[model samples]
Target: MAEKCANVNDSDCSPAKKVKLNDEDAIENTDERNTSENDATPETELNLSNFKVTKVLQNNCVRKSICIKGTFEDREGLAVVLLEQKSFPHDESILEKGFFDEKTLFRKHFTNDIYRNYDCFPTEEYNSIQTTVIYPATQNHIEKYKRHELYMIDETYELYQQVTLPYIESKSLSLEWITNILEHKAEQESIIYEDSDKDTGFVLITDFKWDKQLDTLKLLALPFQKIKSLRELNASHLPLLRNIRDAGTTAISKKFNIPASQLRIYFHYQPSYYYLHVHFCYLMFEAPGIYVAKAHLLSTVISNLELMSDYYTKAVLSYVVFKDSPLYEKFKSRGALETSTCETLDCK
Candidate 1:
């Protein structure tokens, strides 16, 4: 019978390793290893599960070897002994204990109260694979990662989506085109309003729905004829300010302490802005590096915002708010005032 290979990567197969099926035939087969294959015998099932600790090897590294079994279904019952960085400086013979501790330890504190409910999945890049599947941990966040973006899974084993800031990619939607679309959309939908303060010099105000899924304002364009140079907005404009803090080891320096350098512009809506407070807090944590700590800090802060922000105000104006509007949600999650109570939208 002819044997077939499936699911396994090409690198795993070689002519030298092909199984001799019969007197004259050699099969380079990668058969389905699913547990449900009817042909698999009970004895085979027992052997599959009978994984035992075989060997542990560590060379020229600060950490020791850990070996386990049954964790990997495809491998020959030998599972790698993964250890958290905190567990380092341990005894090498500890591998004989059969199982390494599976507990996770947090080195630094989480500022969910000050920040909000935010989780960052570290990025994993495979040059061979050209697709990306975004698995956002929460419904509130907009997962923004492209196919070619470089990423890595950190010690926490979370995928971080790498982003290049000041990455200026301009969509074709210009102010004039956006204005036309809004005007047409407003005429059709009676709910929207367009106001131009002729006396106040070309300042146009358009209001529409706020889309929660897209995290964007439903309205296409702001009525302002021309927005001048935008500035880095402070906390005073929007009462809801969620600040994320993660202190890593390398960040300890003189420049960051005197004045916090803004890390990234997370949300920008006219005068209202939200930034990830990475520099100050991350430097203080004494983390080995910035990547893991930054992701943890940003994720925790966003998570906190989701819990406190008044959903009622955000709910009604959902249509006007741009769909997938990360900016609005960033502020709302940080604890925005009740839509009814906050009369002043003059964030600028």
Candidate 2:
């Protein structure tokens, strides 16, 4: 949830004050392991039964996360309740507890406990949440949590070399980690699949966001080639693309037992980082940045390259640019997307 910043000096909005509030509200209790019934030892359940949901801010079933904008029946104003099922630790012993189990859930602090959610896994905890509820949630809170305006401007082959390319180069970002991974200096143990073919080679590693879970699985395939994002891919890169599409799929099937049918393999245009990488996640995962406006399917990319050697080089690509994105300022400076629709998806 966004920090409701009215004025930085506002006592209620101060980080110090929030920390103090969380400290006071922290629920001190032993791990209430596997309680199949209603609670007896109560500091209140932080129940949402009375929350009158006026709107759903975001709902991603793949990630088991939901955000709702609403007000409690007993409350006077709006509120935002974000509840997401906590991730499991990678520890095999704790991961044995599946969705079939009888288990109890605990929210460490009545207000802030997202960090403590992981502690419950070892206690046979099948589900828990690091949730946040912003009550009397003013329009300010709603605006902060509200989805931003996304303009899908079409970038042609000319626009790439002229406007977008210059804009991208102007921004300085770090990729030392990418180098470390490719050189085998980092994340050595986490690499589940690897190919050292030099040109078409890549190491498939587990993404931090996914702690080895099946449903919300996330894996990244980083190629040894120095090719930056999808923009750099052309006919000559078909081998690398096909390797990622075919070999990565086979490796995932062998390692995770997830069939090719159940996976979403794609590349992000205007990727979070400029480095080239392929993302693989459970089809149901709905991981961030998977919207059509950003994600280009690996299969589709392969076909595009197969059909036209310079498909990406000469293609007109439509992609979203968030207002807060680093690329946003660049686009604004160049008047790059000046004519695109600037519609806002407000919570109201």
Candidate 3:
């Protein structure tokens, strides 16, 4: 049962500009993608050939993963493609002529790009939130973590001031992308609901990964107020939480024709960014941050606030910290994690 393609190079299966539809980045590239041998995500179905590039939002060709975020012709959302450039195979580098020099390789393979003043020049510089997982959906990896490692974080006001506040203030995160979308500067079509409540107002937008598909629905609702993370929430912020759950969810369901019952609404404790936002995804869709370690149910947060005015302000939050996250080092230094090393968690 060994069928062979006459010219593998020309075959559809052959590696042709290997790219991936990264869930973290909210875009998809297809066919073949390069990855560290152990970590492989499920491949999504998207035909970028039909996509006509209108603008290059970001091109991080220098990072560990070379990615380019862009806008496509007639397409409303953003699309990110990780150009797998210089990761050339060793055998392919066995030059049959003059020895390979830096200049020769640069001339032959490197792609030159020009960035604007405000562009996310070296994409590695910014930190963004992500919810999907590409890891093999094995019962062991998923089920075991939920049973053993998941812990609820009770973030007391004192703990937040001592631990969380300092780390956020230290890292000057770039909020240019969020700011652009809110001010009608970018991804205007992706906007689902624009709450003009001022104090509790927010702009909800669909995830770029959806690509107009509703099967695996996704969205991000950014609050207009600079509330930072869930730790800042109290009963006073109930309007924001409830608005996201009700108005936001309703918009998604009505626009997409998806029922509200199928939606899973929640917020991330240690959100990828310093900005306060809510995540809405299909209940059947299990993204990376949906786990108890990170995701806090929107309804649960509402209920907790209703019970006590200062529930979140005085709660003892318990959440996971990856071995590689900057927060992990901060927590370890302050003895917040209860161990010098984190053996069970992932590497951020």
TM-scores, one per candidate: 0.18, 0.60, 0.56
Question: Candidate 1: where are CA atoms >4 Å away?
Answer: 1-176, 181-191, 198-221, 232-348
Model 1's lDDT to the true fold? Answer: 0.23
Q: Residues 255-341, candidate 3, lDDT per residue (tens digit)? A: 666777898888887776678888888887655478765788899999999999888877776676544355666665666665423
Candidate 2: segments with Cα more than 4 A from true spot: 1-84, 87-148, 324-326, 338-348
- Model 3: residues >4 Å from true position, as ranges? 1-156, 340-348
Model 3: ten consecutive residues of lowest lDDT: 4-13
Query: Mind giving the per-residue lDDT tens digits that candidate 1 earns over 147-194?
Result: 111212111101001111121121111233233333443222211222
lDDT tens readout by residue for model 2, 272-322: 566788898899876677877788999999889889887888889988765
Poorest stretch of ten by lDDT in candidate 1: 25-34
Give model 3's TM-score versus the native structure.
0.56
Rank order by lDDT, top first?
Answer: 2, 3, 1
What is each predicted model's overall lDDT from 0 to 1? Answer: 0.23, 0.65, 0.56
Best by lDDT: 2
Work out candidate 3's RMSD over C-alphas: 19.3
